[model samples]
Target: MTAVLPERVEVAIVGAGQAGLAASWHLVQRGVDHVVLERATAFHDWQDRRWDAFTLVTPNFQCRLPGFAYDGDDTQGFMTRAEVGAWLGRYRASFDPPLLEGVEVVGLTRAEDGFLLRTSAGELRAAQVVIATGGYHRPVVPPLGLRLPDGVVQVHSADYRNAGSLPEGAVLVVGSGQSGAQIAEDLHLAGRRVHLALGRAPRSARRYRGRDCIAWLEEMGVYDVTVQQHASGLAKRESTNHYMTGRAGGHDIDLRAFALEGMRLYGRLTDASDGVLRFAPTLAQYLDHADSVMESIKNDIDAHIARAGIQAPVEARYSPVWVPEEEPAALDLAAEGVTSVVWATGFRPDYRWVEVGVFDGTGHPTHRAGETDVPGLFFLGLPWLSTWGSGRFAGVARDAAHVAERLAARAGAPVPA
Candidate 1:
């Protein structure tokens, strides 16, 4: 049910996802008056955008929303897409936040007093606004995709549902990020012939020594590493996440192993024309880079284990199970009976509706931990907004709290004791 839109509120939070809800929780605790505007139903992205077989890449324990942490028995286990949606539902019910569903904020402009939000409902004014819609706004596909044969179906990773939904034939998945790798695996397991185009995204071990790599990284303070403290500086924010999977109790996504199992691997998809696709001659180089990254992570873990004198089980290091002999530069898609293409290319931010000057040249919001130079505006649920986990369930609570505190201070609201 849609909540009645208020004419004015002390705070207006755009997007009722994890970050927005978390911020709302904090604001409620502080006895602040705020309304959360959601374009769709709460947690709609988790339920709609994800594929049927999708599961969390991170462990269940990491789903730490403000005042509500994952309390399930399988703390180390990954939640399926349904489970994630249910969890978020439980969080919302626990708080009964003042939220309006089906209200899209189309434009945001500075008001004489604070800010004016032009929404599907009507104009609402607030003294402060929290932009927590997240970074994945628009799905991106290359212009080369337009040149593909008309018979071939093309879908972005966001729109991909399952293998059975596509035409019966070989499938080509472009990109090797988490979604790409996992989607390819899903198709392969479903008895579909899979051909994957590899990107520069590195792979990582799911588990090492006595724990999940994520757990080890948490212990090593990897997730807590702030964007400013990161060695790569702000560039780390744009880095592709290492590929792994939490499907079937977590495992590594070895493209090499997939290749051995009859999944045709190719380098980056360069161009498409006349029912044919061209690939770069860098399959071996890309694979080696992925392996080296995985090994480098393991090396760090080994060093940490030695330094901490932790007597965990010693394990054999990974050796390449398969290698590319010759880099295939071209594929006749029509001849190979390739029926569909899954472009797991990633997304670009779209804040064109936001008239605020808080964004940088790249259109990413310019903020320090969600606080923009504009006093009444802030951004949240962005990758590396504060730390490695800033955008994930593990760290959004902290970031939301930070934003809520700032918002409260700006509004002259006293935090609860």
Candidate 2:
């Protein structure tokens, strides 16, 4: 049965994730009457999707929302998914943010004054709409054009938690990002013989006085660059790689090290048969590719430091974690009793529910911080919206404040308290 539709509201925000929550907090602080619609029962997606040993790459000190910060005493610490979820709950309580939970947004269409949002519950009309849903909504699996044999079990990283959840066998983890590396490490630790398909070797940070590389970026205003500044495309691409992985430290667990200890590193999977996985030679080439990228980043950082006349010592301390020198002559799958393949590739943004005509050529919504080309539409949680820091928890508040100010000005009201 179709539920009743609200005739009108001043603003309607979609997806109650971090971005949506941040936007609502700002809207309420400005006394802009708004309602947030979340499809889930709570902020359960990020919490539930994380693996058992997963933690934030960014430390807790940087995990602040608009009015609130992470309350824990550990400032130089990383927060687990559970801790992040708990903090989000506190953030929701602090503002009493008006959130309509379990209401999935199905479609959106342009209305005369603003937009009409159709949801699972019903319809909502609002003068302004903020699409604050994060980037990881859609999971991208390997483009295995050929059909796999029935004996092989395959699952995406989103559904994976631990080795126990995987089918019994030698496991092959595809992708080399934080998720893939961490999962490979965990499964190896659990006594499962593992194989990792290396895509790219990401530059890892060398710990300096027991702090992450991101802390330095925060201090250096690297995260403060915005689209308005006309930053180089290389700068934006490098920023994505820089923050994707964890650094080396006593607490740090290196995936390459884990692979050297037990797991086998293979190139891209070419094809698979009845329990047999084939690989290409590209894996060896990736090491050089990764090293060049890292070298470029190091040079860029050094140049930036020198140009800015900053005196802080810049250093690269950690060595690349060891991988096998040569590919194995033959990887015997039947001998090891391999059974499952976990695709830790990554996620893509799915905007099918978003029916508006604001996306760019690459299918990403084109916006300035949060303002869309369409006046009443806005976006949040996009990568490098204002600066490198704009997407992180520490950076989001400033963007939120900016969006709130713009919204108030559009409404012809003084900035809300």
Candidate 3:
């Protein structure tokens, strides 16, 4: 039976993902009364949003919820999509939180006593609300996609399942972030012709100097540095994550290497019209930027190793396997036999339903470590909320704990020990 929505609550959590569930765990420990509202079943995104071949980019050890650190034998291996869903399911069962699975909070506004939430079920009042729905609310597909021929099938990265599911023929994948790069590799590995449009997103080596880049960074305290301590400050939140894959025991995602293996690479997609796509002549720049970023990371790792006097095997730097001699300015879809297009562009934040003044000009919530200017409204699960790991499983635990403590204290309840 579905849980009935409560008309009022001492505290309300607007999402039930890892971030919100972590908060619930902390609240439960402190004996704080709160209800968690989830738009769908818990951990639905982990099971549904990812493609058939999707594996975690981060290692299993980073799966650190409040009381649920990964206990599996393969601590260094990445979890498959189903494994991730099951892990989150186990976490949910461990706490049995007061969760309304189908409750969708459509609108939120300030109430006289606290905050008023207009949800799909009905109106409810929460003295303190934790918005943990995360930043990826909508998939961004450009309007130019419509200009392509009607016969061509276009799918957003969020909706893509696998190469076998797409129409037979060559596939044009536009974007080179984590999703775009990995998806292209998936298609290429499946013996499908792939045309990948590169972007400015940086890349990272999977393993370096006899250790995973993530492990090295962890030992260097890179993930623990607060957003305020970084040179970019809050602006660091806008940076695209460096791309690497944990698929098949982990490896670097080198687009140039993919090019050497018969994958067609192009610059950023500028426009599409009359069944023809135009690309900017910046393919070399994109590839060069990605390589430089990877090298910079290795440089940092070398410095850390030197400073710590750690004995690790020295690894040589990467060299480009293939480089584009001349940029491909345009491509006719019909001529190239491209039957499908995948728009792997990133998402934009959508807070139109929020009727509060705590957001900035860019529609991002303005907060100091999840505490908004609005007294009882807090935003959690945002990238770089406190650190680079704020929105990720590796870091959400700390952010959730901090938010739960603040919310409990604000409501005159005992804070978590």
In candidate 2, what are the lDDT values of residues 1-417, reduced to their tens digit? 333447788888887878788888887877888888888755677666888767777877788888899899877777777777888889889988888888898998899979999898878899988887876778888667244556668888888888998887888888877677777877887899898887765644534433455675676676777666754752452333432433221144455566668778888767765556677877667655665555565565566567887776656645777755776533556666767878887887789888888887667777767788898888877677677677678777788777777876776666544
Clashing pairs in 1: none
Model 2's alpha-carbon lDDT is 0.73
Candidate 1 wrongly placed segments (more than 4 Å): 1-3
Give all candidates' CA lDDT scores: 0.92, 0.73, 0.90
Best by lDDT: 1
Task: For candidate 3, report its TM-score.
Answer: 0.98
| TM-score to true structure, per model | 0.98, 0.88, 0.98
- Tens-place lDDT per residue, model 3, 299-330, is 99999999999999989899888889899999
Best by TM-score: 1
Q: After aligning candidate 1 to the native by TM-score, how far in Å is the CA of 49 from where it should be? A: 1.0
Model 1, span 159-228: residue lDDT tens: 9999988999999999999999999999999999999999999999999987999998889988899999
Q: What's the number of clashes in each of the models?
A: 0, 5, 0
